[model samples]
Target: MDQTLTELRTVNVIRYVTPLREGGSMPAIVEADDGFLYVIKFRGAGQGTNALIADLVGGELARALGLKVPELVFIHLDEGFGRSEADEEIQDLLKFSVGLNLGLHYLSGAITFDSTVTQLDPLLASKILWLDCLLTNIDRTCRNTNMLIWNKELWLIDPGASLYFHHNWSNWKEHILTPFALVKNHVLLKQASKLNEADVFCKQLLTTERIESIVALIPTDWLKDEPLFESKEAQRNAYTTFLLTRMQHSDIFIKEANDAREKLI
Candidate 1:
């Protein structure tokens, strides 16, 4: 457990159990020295470290906002841990990711949240929907909620699609006031009856200082090779700046959410 990173723990991978190839990343279930199973996010994943960074920051923000999220850890990959893997893909991924990677503690027996089969408290739904809007996350649609149900509670997962500004920082200004109209397609949109309230609460929590701290959580190794920024520090500044600006204009998104809610409800 690194003291600098606060509550986020660090664990070493003990064994690679299996590959979860549902997504391009091909994250795997690996047993950690901590005696827990974690869905490992490989650095070699197609999206590269961008996806891992997004997952780390977005999931942490969710937890900070009192949303249910799985425990995230920094898992150190041993040099020879995946050498004996039967799958060439997994072996290659493991070889490339023989360093630090992201891991979500596996929630055994957790079921995927299906709106048709379950209903969430309106406030919870609004809070989640608001966070997605704030992060500009485009992956939480009905077709792909990226959510799970464990212990009879909704838990967020797979936040890799967030912080879109990093992908196209060229005209990030044009994107700041960008209306997240796609939020209407969000899985929780139907149940987010309190979007306005959620917006206020989240805006208060996501202050500039908080945004800066969250961006600092990104690993330095992941901040390299950027086409837009000159250095990792610059990249970190860009993230916090983008998020701080977005937080200022949250009303734009809140209105978009409420407008969408009006049509749905």
Candidate 2:
């Protein structure tokens, strides 16, 4: 474990609360102390240990990818509140309840997919696609646009569906090959000059070393009995390979956007 993670456990910033929503693999929410907020996720025996590891690994990887994800930490508590009598489980449930209450009264402003990303912003759309590709995130679809926009910035939330690629990876590949027609003719891709800037940004953010490091930080339990390579190093290499492969496929969409732009002119 990283030393920073150990120190983060000691901070008294986290407060467990009740859930605000119910769609994620595990229930969770952000508890704030003063102005700072910490994302707290509850792990019950019902979810099993593997799910907990997935959450931690996915959260860490998102942060490494330069995406706007909330800060996460494990909050410990005494048993007797939920199943297994484990303090960890009890603390998680408490935090979830608190988060639900807070979101209901306070952060009532909600943004839906109908108004998220406009069809004109092909460059921004491409950037999002590239990030999703690198992370093997298969849940960002038309109906469940998990990305939220508040204060003019995009924030990623509810990643409980990522990393378990065995379930949705095939669906993701099908979509990537066909491409989303709506974003194909976006204006941002029309300007070749703008793509150079986006390409640069992507290159800077998704480095091989950083990807490998993030994969290493994922809890080993999440990969249990999965068809992936046995060793951690091998698993990291495999994940990196998957990300690169997805990026290659995404390039075709970018090219299509460029072609559409040329036709328009």
Clashing pairs counted in every model = 0, 14
- Which 10 consecutive positions of candidate 1 have the poorest summed lDDT? 1-10
Q: Highest TM-score among the candidates is held by which one? A: 1
Per-residue lDDT value at 144 in model 1: 84
Candidate 2 global CA lDDT score: 0.47
Minimum summed lDDT over a 10-residue window in model 2 is located at 97-106
List residue ranges in candidate 1 displaced over 4 A: 1-7
For all predicted structures, in order, the TM-scores are 0.94, 0.58
lDDT of 1 by residue, 1-265 (tens): 1112355789999988888878678899999999999999988888888889999999988887878889999999989877788888788888999888999999999988899999998888999998898788999988888999999888999999998777767887777787799898999999999987888788777666666777888889987666777787987888887778887888899899899888998
> What would the per-residue lDDT of candidate 2 be over residues 131-160, giving only the tens digit for each residue?
544444556665676666655565566555
